[model samples]
Target: MSAPVIAIDAMGGDFGPHCIVPASLACLAEIPSLHLALVGQTPLIEKLIDRQPGVDRARLQIVHASEVVAMSDRPAQALRGKPDASMRVALEMVRQGRAQACVSAGNTGALMALSRYVLKTLPGIDRPAMMAALPTRAGSCHLLDLGANVDCNAEHLYQFAVMGSVAAETLGVRRPRVALLNVGTEEIKGNQQVKLAASLLRQAPGLNFIGFIEGDGVYRGDADVVVCDGFVGNILLKSSEGLAEMVAEKIRDLFSRNLASRLLGAVALPLLRSLREELKPATHNGASFLGLQGVVVKSHGGAAEDAFQSAIRRALVEIHENLPQRLHGRLEDLLL
Candidate 1:
């Protein structure tokens, strides 16, 4: 089979060129069959590419872009005005069939807007959702509507759950347990949106609706499919990331306290490593923009080399699985 084409938005993250370059290199090394089209200023990417000794320039290509949409910039305005922006350019690659998938760490709203406009939503999917895989004792669980559709209705949430379940199936989970994220485990606890969605999910066909899941429940390994509106989902995604970082910092601080503590820390190094690996933010790097006509993987804006590499790996996997077709098959509402 031909290698999959990945359009990398090299101008998005805080580290920008630096992170994209190394991450692209790392991804190429890890996945030899992958093809990349780095979307950004050609001169900058050329500099980064040249720094690598004897690297095959043919494997990696650049799509020159003079403009960039800042994260702080308004989504619609930036995307509309900056036609030459790296993110939009990369997305256009998918539209024109130049690439199979696009990876970016740019303005989340702009990315979502451009993707919906260009790729369009699949049949049965009302709006595309951002899906992330979270670490759990049972393995990584798929969490959906992570800031894509903030004002989703009942049907939106139900479809997100279905699409998320399909993704879980790809990850080898059979009959994944689905749960609605609400304040209380009871049916009537949350706002109108959650309450309505809960009822719909409860009656939704072909899903394993495990009822309501709370914030604490997420950490306790409550369910395989965690569903929420984009607003709540975005908050939870960041909150989980912040908590993970804080825990890692606290552990590192304990090891630095004194010589005796350092010795004790050395003894616990293996366990700490396990925890760190388990909680490694990069492990769950790519957030699948579920419901798009095509698969668009969003890498964290502040992602480092490892995180971006993880995004590339995810794009590769999705391409091979023909994820977009499978997702369209499951969520027929998007086509309407």
Candidate 2:
């Protein structure tokens, strides 16, 4: 079999090709069989490519895209206006079967809209939920609708639950425990939509619904999958990211306070480094747009080189697992 090829939106993110080029180099070095198609303005991408000496050019190819979808552009505007945008071009490669997956640290809305437009939803899927890996005490949990369907109904949330369950299984959990994010654990808690969704999940045959999980319970390793509407999920994701940054900063401040503290920090440096690594958002930067026919990974727009590499790694996993195909089969079995 030929090596897996990933299409990357080279000019998509805040740092653009500056970060992506180095990340691509690292990925290529780490995974020998991986090929990368960096789609964007040729000149800019070439400039970064020129910076890396003795790199294997054969495994890396650049597909030129004239326009770019800015982070500030509305999804509708981007969809209509920038037909040649880097993000669009990358997804196009996936649609054409030129690449197994597409990775973009671009505008989330534009990526989702363009991906849906290009790849379409999987059979039986009404909409694709933005699913991502969230750090938890029990290793990691899959959270869905990170910001895709803001006004989801019970049926939509139910679909997210089903997709999340499949995703968790793909990520190595068998018969993953699923939960709905709510204000309380009681069946009576939450709005009508959540309550109704919970009812549907409970009635889902073969689904291991573990009841409701509050915001406080999310990181406590309570469940393998946490399902919620995009609005709530987005808020939780950003809030947790901000809180992790704050806590890490506070630890740095605490360690730098005085000579004695500095000495203590030296003694505990390795442990502190490990803890910091666990808390960093970059380590868990990629979000999978589940329920789509093609594999699409959304990297943080402000991601650094290492973070972008992480997103590429994520796309590799999904591609190798043939996640979309597996998910389609699972959806067929459960929903049909």
Candidate 3:
């Protein structure tokens, strides 16, 4: 079979093609069966490609899009104004079956809005959710509703749990332990909505429903999947990212403090490098807008080349696993 074609919004991120072109070439070098459509202004993309020698022209093409969705643009404004934006064009490619998946590091709200408009939700999915994997003691755990449906109901949270389970399984977890993010582990420790959601999750068929997981439990790998409303999920995502940055900065400061510390740092360089690589948010950059009809991975707008590459790989994985199809089946089975 032919390789899956991924349509990328080359001009979407803060650095645009400066970061995307190199990452595309890197991914193509490693993945033999991957084709890429870099959608953006033709001249800019061609210029970057020209600077990079030996790109397989046959496997990579530039699709011109006249407009771009700015990082500062509101979701509603973007949808109405930037009809020819690279982000929308990439989604159109997926809608027309020109690409197996689409990846972007554009405006999060705009990306999510355009995706739902272009791809629609699966049969059983009332609203889509955004999810990503975070490094945990047990390797990694999938966390859902990262920022998609900010105001979700108990049923929505329940659906998130199901979708998160499917995603965790696709990432190689079998019978993932799904849990609701709560203030306390006890059944009655949360708000009415969370308490109600927990009740629904416990009775949810085919879900390995673990009772509740506090915020700290998220890193302890207490559950393979953690489900929460987008409001809370977004806060958690941002806070975790901030904390990671703070810790890395502290480590650097500690190492550069004095001659003795510098000597110790030199000796511990290899171990510190390994730890940094494991903890870097860039390594886990992409977040999937789950429950949509097609595969769409969202890269951080400020991502560098390596981080963008991580997002592309994420899209590839979802495409290979036929995530949407599998998620549909799982939802149907759970509902029945």
Predicted structure 1, TM vs. truth: 0.93
Question: Cα deviation in Å at residue 271, candidate 2?
Answer: 2.7
Compared with the true structure, what per-residue lDDT tens digits does model 2 show for residues 1-336? Answer: 478899999987898888888898889888888999999999998988888887788999999999999999999989999999999999999999999999999999999999999999998999999988787887878888899989999999999999999888887898999999999998789999999999889889888999999987888989989999999998988888788888777887888899999888778776777766666553457889999989999998988888888899889989989999989988888788
- Each prediction's Cα lDDT score? 0.83, 0.89, 0.89
Sequence-dependent TM-score of model 2: 0.96
Q: How far out, in Å, is residue 274 in model 3?
A: 3.1
Global Cα lDDT for candidate 1 = 0.83
* lDDT tens digits, residue span 37-70, model 3: 9999999889888888888988997899999999
Of the two candidates 1 and 2, the one with more favorable TM-score, higher being better, is 2
Backbone clashes for every candidate come to 8, 0, 0
- Positional deviation of residue 105's Cα in model 2 after best superposition, in angstroms: 0.3
Question: What is the per-residue lDDT of model 1 for residues 1-336, given as tens digits with 9 covering 90 to 100?
Answer: 577789999999778988888788877866778889999999999999888876666788889999988888888787578888998899889989889999998878999999998899887677888888888766667788888788888888888888888887876688999998989997669888788888777777778889998987876778988998989988887777778878888998899799998999889866887777567553447888887877699888887788888888888888888889888776654323
In model 2, which regions exceed 4 Å deviation? none
Clashing pairs in 3: none
Off by over 4 Å in 3: none
